[model samples]
Target: MAIGDAQVDAADLETVAQQLGRTPRGTRAIASRCPSGHPNVVQTNPRLPDGTPFPTMFYLTCPKLNSLVSTLEGSGLMKEQTERLAEDPELAAAYQRAHESYLAERDAIESLGTQVTAGGMPSRVKCLHVHVAHALAKGPGVNPFGDEALALLREQALWPAGDCSAS
Candidate 1:
């Protein structure tokens, strides 16, 4: 394993070793035979029911996992906020007030809809390239463009540490 790789618990490690007819040390020796096979270096480490380690390991790009975790965490936070707002009478009243105001504004707009238009016909215009730049960014989990440009950016960012000079 690398100097600071994530690891499964000792109990899980022992269980995996036992299932394979080997000691925990032996299993770790085999699994960590190389940095590539090490749990810390790898993306995933499986454990037995009792939280023992398993032989097989799976690897994935860390940035992808980071993006997924961030998105899921945000979703969970939003869910909690929504639930709390639903259960709070003060918040509910505020929401109801806003809802009524929105409805009144909508009705006013509808009443005037026919008066505001292009030659008596309502028309909608939108800005071009509104999201173009945003869509261009290579965010976490996004490996677009085959990582070449991103690798260059990464190198430029690292500079002396690892060639992180921006492309």
Candidate 2:
């Protein structure tokens, strides 16, 4: 489910903390949830509470999804996607748009005065976890790499197999 920057309550924060194994800093809202209605993606503040510049606006918090995305990253998918970005102009354009969109959303919340978006966007694929989180939070077609990663996960039968809520 898309939570979309709505006010997060104590239970949600507690769940996010459990998922991260620490208290989440600068969490503005629960961005998205898994099939079991547990927060899988969170919309974070552009600048963290401690005055740190946080470029990652969308963060994936689901352990199951994190593990699966890590598997994809370990398989050198990032390198392949990065290479494709150099060769495919259309893809590069789409990815640029995604980066711009991410920046606009984050800047709307709080401008960090930087063009750097998360997950090596518009140029390379650095983290599938971030990409997947972006796709999950914004839905498909927003981020090409993100959409591709989600599709690959689904094709591999590694996504939506069951509830991913923390026990």
Candidate 3:
């Protein structure tokens, strides 16, 4: 699959389901893939087939990555980052831009008529998973916190060394 490709095939869906350990609802595309060509991030619809509004547009699917992010989250990274947002004006501005960009992208797909973007953007760091997924899907230099989280993982040698698709 190529970047920004909206097509979601059956095999990819199956792989995503296996990664998630459940059926993925409102997934519109495989947003990003791991080195082994497995869906690591997914672009989801603003609304589900059942007409339920879903705010998260990009979702992380690789179990290894998910677990790694969870570990980071468990380390109180989100709370620390949220505190930094208040003291760091530049980072706060960049995060606001990220939030706006996320809203625009999701609104383009289908508006949920709300300002809510995922991961508590614009003011706080809520979920590193959403940030990492956004960073992977859109590439580097978009989400500051996401880039920071990935850097932290790399610096700590916590990043997965093998194919993360195999779980």
Best by lDDT: 3
Q: Which model, 1 or 3, shows the larger TM-score?
A: 3
lDDT by residue (tens digit), candidate 3, 1-105: 322336788899889889888998888998888877888999998998888998999999999889999999999999999999999899999999999999999
Model 2 TM-score, 2 decimals: 0.94
Give the clashing residue pairs of candidate 3, or none. none
33 Cα displacement, candidate 1 (Å): 58
Residue-level lDDT of model 2, residues 1-167, one tens digit each, is 22335578789889989999998988888889988998999888888878899888999999998998898899999999999988989999999999999999988988999899999987888888889999999998999888988899899888877878743
Reference-based TM-score of each model: 0.23, 0.94, 0.94
CA displacement after TM-score superposition, residue 111 of candidate 1 (Å): 6.5
Alpha-carbon RMSD of each model:
22.2, 2.8, 2.5
Model 1 error, position 70 (Å)? 11
- Residues 7-68, candidate 1: write the lDDT tens digits: 45565454334333454331221221111221211212234335544322222212222233
Q: How many steric overlaps does candidate 1 have?
A: 13
Of candidate 2, the 10-residue stretch with the lowest lDDT total is 1-10
Q: State, as a TM-score between 0 and 1, how close model 3 is to the true structure.
A: 0.94
Give the Cα error of residue 9 in candidate 3, in Å.
1.5
The global C-alpha lDDT for each of the candidates, from Candidate 1 onward, is 0.28, 0.88, 0.89
